[model samples]
Target: MIPRMGAGVVRNGRELVKGMSAAVPIAIGYVPIAVAFGVIARQSGLPFAETVLMSMMVFAGASQFMAVQMATAGALGMEIIFATLVLNFRHFIMSLSLMDRLKDVPLLAKGALAFGVTDETFAVAAMDEKGGNGRIHPLYMAGLIAVAYGSWVFGTVVGGLFAGVIPRSISDSMNIALYAMFIALLVPAVRKRWRVGAIALIGMALNALFGLFLSGGWATVLATVAAAGCGTMLMPREEPPAAEKTAG
Candidate 1:
């Protein structure tokens, strides 16, 4: 038992190293955007501590930005919570999918893992699992999450601290960096799957239409749901013939 436990520890350590290495690109991508978020949150009247706290607790970039925007616009607490919830609904789907890959993990570990499962981390883990025939090392995932989380928190602190030092014009321009980061993530996925591009366009159009008559958060929620429904309906699925199943 002692030998076996020692081997397990060694294996997990190696896996952690690999996970951290794989997370370098994600860390790099998160820094500028997180800094931008920090800057925006600070400029929008959030205290430096609150800005960092949001990054630590919320962790989702888009939702954090929306929360900051809503808060700055004097939105009510309930409204802010609802908007954040709506925007982060995708995390539920991502977490469910990841659960299948982590069936052998303990509930406590799974809970911790769920908190770190951002879009970028999900993408990386999914690809890694696929390439490894569905075997993802939990320690590796922990390492990946640690690096990404640390980078985001650190970036937010740095941005918040420098918010006063940076010129107003430059700080305002940092807002575009978030959108550019999103576009960078989206374009590659759309290129790989044409359906993704169609869904994105549909969402954009619907959001625009809804924006004309509704609140920003509600418009976003409705457009997202509509686009997802359309995408589900349009997605192609293959069905094997009855004869093929019988032959087996």
Candidate 2:
């Protein structure tokens, strides 16, 4: 339904809520993994507050887990920063992809939006493209990021405060959520687009090959760039649907 000027506020509210609803699956996967990260950080001799603070600040799952593990081993500050910088190199690509898609979003808002573009959020936003307007609404993007960002911080607090209280077996098993969430997102897209499936397979193969010699960070970046190039050149491009003209 088209909203009157007065209803703009209500329309915005609905879009925000809708975006948050769409991210529930992501939250389910993230919370458990975040909790595990918190437990591991605490057990690895990180202070409880710092563990939660890391989640709030870094917000990158794999990097956070790796950083805590590295820190536990008595790594130097510069070493930890360099390792995380390498690990999170993929964020550069993710940020660029989002920037292109969100042409209508405000310039000031883009930075905040980019900060929230994790792997899961990027996947969901890409799949949920706003075809009609050719741009995602800023409020929707905000809500999506809010859920994911909030869940990680909240879970960290829970796990940090009660590190040993949570059973190690349960924390260990939470890793399954990570894989399961990817499969859940992947199957639907692959069913609709064979090219997506093919590109995914190629990425996996290239990552495996590169992993043999390169560090995981470098391997992932290279494989992703290669697979993206493959898709760009090989996949058939479809133009956006034309907008229907209406009498003014």
Candidate 3:
């Protein structure tokens, strides 16, 4: 029993190391964006502590940017919350997909993994060969989450603390960095999947139309839903034949 337990511990540690290793690129990518968020939040009149707190509490990059923009635009509390909710709704689908792959994991671990499921992390996990077997090591996931979370939080704190020393012009220019990051994330996806480009174009057009008639937040939500709904309907679906399915 003692030997078995020892072996289990060693295996778990190795899994964790592998997970952290996989997350290195993601951590590096997050640092600049997290720093940008911190700087922008500070320039938008958020206190240093609040800026860090927002990073800690709401770790989603796009949502954090939206929150800061809405707050600065004099949006109501409910409006900000609703807009953030709509923006993050895709996480629900990501979590559901991971759930099927990680069903063997404990509920507590699943909850923790769910909290850490950012777009980058989800992409990493989904593309992993081990995920093809429908089993993801929880310890490895924990390691990935820990490193990525630490990098983001640390970067936010550093940026917020030093924001006061940055010149006003430079600080103002940092706002564009957020959009640049979004474009960087988008371009690769559009390249890999032509449908992504179509969806994005549709979303942009819908957003413009909606913006002329509705508030910013409402327009964004409506555009997202309309584009996604259209894409789902237009995208092809592959279904296995009924005889093959039964044989399996």
Per-prediction backbone clash count:
0, 0, 0
TM-score of each: 0.88, 0.69, 0.91
Higher-lDDT candidate among 1 and 2?
1
The whole-model lDDT of each prediction reads 0.87, 0.80, 0.86
Model 3 whole-model lDDT (C-alpha atoms): 0.86
> Model 1 Cα displacement at 22 (Å)?
1.5
Candidate 3 residue runs with Cα over 4 Å from true position: 241-248
**Candidate 2, residues 1-248: lDDT per residue as tens digits?**
45576599888999899889988988987887787778878877889988888998899887777676556655566666776776577789988887887887788899999989998898888777576754778888889999999998988888888888877776666556555655776799899988889998998999899989976655656777788789897789785556533322
* Residue ranges of candidate 1 with Cα displaced over 4 Å: 129-133, 238-248
Tell me how far the alpha carbon of residue 76 in candidate 3 is from the true structure, in angstroms, after superposition. Answer: 2.2
| TM-score, model 3 to reference | 0.91
Model 2 alpha-carbon miss at residue 36, Å: 0.5
Worst 10 residues of 2 by lDDT: 239-248
RMSD of candidate 1 to the truth, in angstroms, is 2.7
Cα error, candidate 1, residue 114 (Å): 0.8
